[model samples]
Target: MSRKSETSGDRRPAQADALTLTGRQAARVAKRRRVMMLGLRGIPNVQGGVEKHVEMLSSRLTGHGWEVEVVGRRRYLPVSGPHLWNGVRVSPLWAPRMMALEAIIHTFLGICFAAMRRPDVLHIHAVGPALLVPLARLMRLNVVVTHHGYDYDRQKWGAFAKKMLRTGERMGMRLAHGRIAISREIAETMGERYRVPVAFVPNGVAVSHCDVETGVLGEFGLTRRRYILLAARLVPEKRQIDLIKAYAKLGNTGFNLVLAGGAEFESAYEDEVRALASRVPGVVLTGFQTGDRLAELFANAALFVLPSSHEGMPIALLEAMAHGLPVLASDIVANRQLDLPAGDYFPLGDIDALASAISEKTATSLDEQEVLAQTERVESAYSWSSVALKTLDVYRAVTK
Candidate 1:
């Protein structure tokens, strides 16, 4: 007896069914693969510390098999380009240019997009955008927030804005599925106040050994090791004007005073800083140098000074340490976390003390051993690879 031959028609249906099932599984995997980032102006050479942090973290996450997408402000990012860069995708959404409205508006739009798209994770950076954490939860989205600093403490914000920031901080810490604080101080502050468990993930830096490019020095009329560098945005809290006044009081020590950042919505403050800096001979205002120029400034400066009255974790200070420059910073809790030598810190808001520290530190060069120690500490404590790994662990914990 001959058995009925199996027909191609029956085989074709089974094969098609198997292919369809496989396609659905693959699509599900892809859908589960993405992490959506928000609350930065943009990445890939954007200005703010939050932008830089996201740029490094998001790019590194992609190498670990994450499809990272950052929601950026349209005005900050270029209008025309492929959305994907390297492995991270950038979605530039529109927002007004006004400083007060920019972050909130952009973040609202970003959160809505993440909700509609249904990304596996929605990661928001900084307390300003964390205001929407409750809303994100209501949308049934998994949320993670990184508190860069207490923005309410910043001098630029008005009373209402400051109150809103405080509310955001409270809600974000209480509501997010996972939370990251950038410094020990921040972690402690949040834990003590909000009673929430938070992870401490400090910022990272790229350690390099390039020689100080003399061309940049010449352009700014700076001599190697003859300048004191203060690189931060011109804002009242940063105390750039304090640095200028201190330098002016010191009366033209052969060393130049270099201020290496542009204005950040503080036109009046910027104008005051400029006028003060202009009055002092050898005070160079090199508005916002990045890449090689910034590196050169760090490498060649006699000393790096950050007199900020408030901070989360100062990336400027870390960059200086990476460059192996001697550093003097204000005695704030955030700066204190650096574990710097006691001699390296001046009383906060003390112009005379800052001037004295600058004079003493600049006159006395850092010992070779001290410089090596600083570089070693930076390498051990703040490498991007290590930071990325820790952050990924947080992501995995929340996702699971």
Candidate 2:
């Protein structure tokens, strides 16, 4: 009788232990559904491709039953911005506002903060911040690195900075549990060089839902479909000077060439661009614009040109395409992947070719059918919902 009683007591404890173990397992599953995003400066009206990407992806992830926390830089985010935007938690970490050191320093601090949060996946964006992937991995965090572009190839980086970027690429490829390349071209390039399989997840564009504010157009003295638009950061690799020169060559084209991007950092290139723009007759520098202002600009443009020397799937070009605007992009490998018609692609650095193409495109009437087809293609292939699902797949793969 004593043996039977003892056995019953043992079974009771065993049953309790089983229930406790089940609860712990369930908690782990819950934790695995949470993510920590890093590397982008900040979000919500920020003038950056990566920030836009993070904002869209994070907002969409939550709807699919994933909890997301984005680490933002205090300097970049507005003072009035809330701790939460669209259900994604925002944690701002203080960092110096210097150009070269900001990303690395902020990413280091972000990784430390993420470690404490114990998110299932630590998703790092851009190669600059991927420098600390090894460190994050060492902390036993599941790391997923997204390669935005070949930063080392940018004209602004010095030799040491270039080397650091290359090193970061190496470390990120080797250390991270998974990798995402924003374009097929980027994915193929990285895979060939590093011998690591990467998931190709291109950047997405949202169809503008805002009404075209004609008042904003009047504020800039612009007419509907009578202006050429190039909206991107006023940086060297974007080659705004090249566009300025091309526009200057096409004097009296009747279409005002508008450069609608803000200076990224104080530099000789920006000074040179402004100097060139000053010399040009028809070129307009509208600085940085967003929201309805930017949408109206895109909606009513005669033609959109992206003559960047380099790109990782240019978001500005995608935005123009999303708006059903006729796009003329340089024949850079990334841009070529868009499969624009032969007429739409001008040879890189060919000022005469760009000027001529601009003149020709402006004079010719846009094929509404072609524009509709392009918009359909862009929306179908590069929807944020699709990007979010693919990114979530990467996160789940890494965590599992």
Candidate 3:
């Protein structure tokens, strides 16, 4: 099919013609380019990576003339009903609070809502939710599915859940009208495995001026630039235990280790993380921070470490680099794709190597020139504006 024919009903007119249209006419055009996004917990200070991605991408799509609505689980959302945030409409839908069933149930309900509303496109994020793509297609709704990561590879799921996640990946990649992968590695793997084209639309980072406030530092009893920061949920794949053990290996480093996230659901893993963290001195657990507190944590850390065994273009790592902090990450495919310096990556799940890297990184302060260069590199490559435009192209491709 020709591109113009596929996008005839949804694409905006040429710039010259758009400039000549009346305000009401422009509103009508924007309404025609509607997209409903699902597959995340909630937004507007939600802690998970997918939630942050949807919040950033959906909010920015409004600027480019796409009417955006993010459907999230009612249990996780801060508000009770439909609301407007940053010019995008957010609808909180009903979903059971069970850990295993919440995503698929919420997505099924969101797809049904989309079918009735008949938006120009229904954009689903993550493979777990993408399991319902076939259903959306059965309802004759234009569908776009974004494979955030290989959820089957995450250590949190059981064998049966892992198998189901693999099936979700298969159905989402093969059945959706449009496919997007957040990492180049994921896109390539899906294309090769499913024999389908997948757009590589990476997660983005917004670099903001550093917040010099010390109130949060005081609250946490931390010193500026004297704490090693890891800002991810207390999940098994994130390998918080590895970081804690590595920090214990470094005796008298004078740097506190701060874990700035908590789990959304109750799990034995979270309990284990807390027990292990309490045994080690100089380890602080600040549960699920956001807004200024998270910014403060990012801005004042001595070094940022992401020892995750699984990821889909980690937004926390990107945000840390955007803050000009030196980073150490696991050498997984997703983290390696960031192309950080060779010394910045240690082998995945190697506690000794992670310890050595953390010690070496904290021994010296980052040079002013090096900080500026790192900040510029991340800011240029991972701007949210670029992400929004690329995603809009995907929506246009599948619409009409």
Candidate 4:
């Protein structure tokens, strides 16, 4: 499909022209697997990257004839009724010790549910797999786990909590029938830290399919804006405050800087960003923009920046590239693993370098590195379709 002329400057959907077979005609198509997706969150609405990745993957794999189901905590996804989404079964966790047990009970319920479901393949999305490892083996379930990159590294965990998470994560990775990590960094980390072999499968984005509306920006008097955007959560690891400082250093040069993530669930960190955001001029903190609002924030921005100390192939970065917007990011190992366009990079904590990168982006358009390179390195390597396929391969290996 040829792209029509850009009327409003919004990037349109890329070609999704594929002939697909329906479930009614499932026997006719090549797809032949029943997969149960397990995690703490379910579909239709989810907060994190793992949930979004699984949501999109479930839709794509289902259209291709793979049976899919997602089971998550009832508190996260309401337990009122059983639901179906994009050909995936949605079941709720209902255990007595749930609220008191800090996710232990949720894992217990997940194990019981998985054993009864008897799925041909079970794809676990996080460290929850360790809790279910024994049950899955007992039930003869094919288990595959995907490492979501350093969940244990967050500041929310104290010494004991960190130690527990580390041990559990190691156990989960080791006991899985198969494991997949999103970036070379994660793959290497898992192997080096835990001595576990993990297939590298990075996340992807549908760059062109994004729909952004800056109408909300008008509410903040930032309509038709050309500001830099920082879309990550307000956590220390994400380095959001550093971006705020960079914006402060750049300081209101006809461009408005906007941040559209939530107040941290960790109140102390949230307070730090809030205090930092207050001090930065020409900077608007639109706390926690969701679906359409997030797209709008990305759409109207001149550049997208991720000043994270660490990352595992950020989806927002890919989304920015797909939207054809220039990127300015911290040069972390994970960020370097995926080949992007001629993006500006800054030293991790250097405010001067970050300001320079943002100013350079504001000054001119970034060059597009060769098309074949992007197609091979960006498009082929880290797409939802590719992730779905690699995930299916994991399923096959576990089952066999």
Give lDDT tens digits, candidate 3, residues 1-400.
5766645676555744665789899777656688899898878888798999998898888888788898888877779899988998889999997889989998999998999989888988999998889999999999999999999999989999998899989999999999999999999999999999999999999754545674888998999899999999989999999999999999878999999999988999999999999999999999998887789889989999999999999999999999999999999999999998899999998999999999899998789999999999999999999999998888878864
lDDT digits (tens) for residues 1-400 of candidate 1 = 1233343445566444554667777565554568899989887777778988898888898888788999988877765443987789899888888989999998999899999988888999999899999889989998999999989999988999999999889888999999999998898889999898999999998854456464878988899899999988888899998888899889968999999988746578888888887788989998877777788788888999999999888888998988889899999988999898899899998999988988899888878998888898897889888888988878888888
Tens-digit lDDT track of model 2 for 1-400: 4666645655675444554567777565446488899998787778888888888889999998788999988877776344888898888888887889989999999999988989889999989899999889889899999998898999999999999999999898878999999999889888998999899999998866566454867877888899999999888899998888998887786788899988756989888988998888878899988888888889889899999987887888998998888889999998998888899999999999999998888887668897788889899989999999999889878866
Q: Which pairs clash (backbone N, Cα, C closer than 3 Å) in model 1?
A: none
lDDT by residue (272-293, candidate 4, tens digit) is: 8888778777788887666676
- Candidate 2 off by > 4 Å: 1-32, 80-82, 212-214
lDDT score for residue 14 of model 4 = 28
lDDT of 2: 0.87
How many angstroms is residue 358 displaced in model 2 relative to the true structure, after the best TM-score fit? 0.4
> TM-score for every candidate vs. truth?
0.91, 0.91, 0.92, 0.83
Q: Among all windows of ten consecutive residues in candidate 3, which has the lowest summed lDDT?
A: 10-19
Pairs that clash in candidate 2 = none
Question: TM-score winner among the candidates?
Answer: 3
Q: Which candidate tops lDDT?
A: 3
| Model 3 alpha-carbon miss at residue 187, Å | 0.9
For each candidate in turn, give its C-alpha RMSD to the true structure in angstroms: 4.7, 5.2, 6.0, 11.3
Among all windows of 10 consecutive residues in model 4, the one with the lowest summed lDDT is 12-21
Stretches off by above 4 angstroms in model 4 are 1-32, 78-80, 94-103, 128-132, 192-196, 208-214, 263-266, 340-343, 367-377
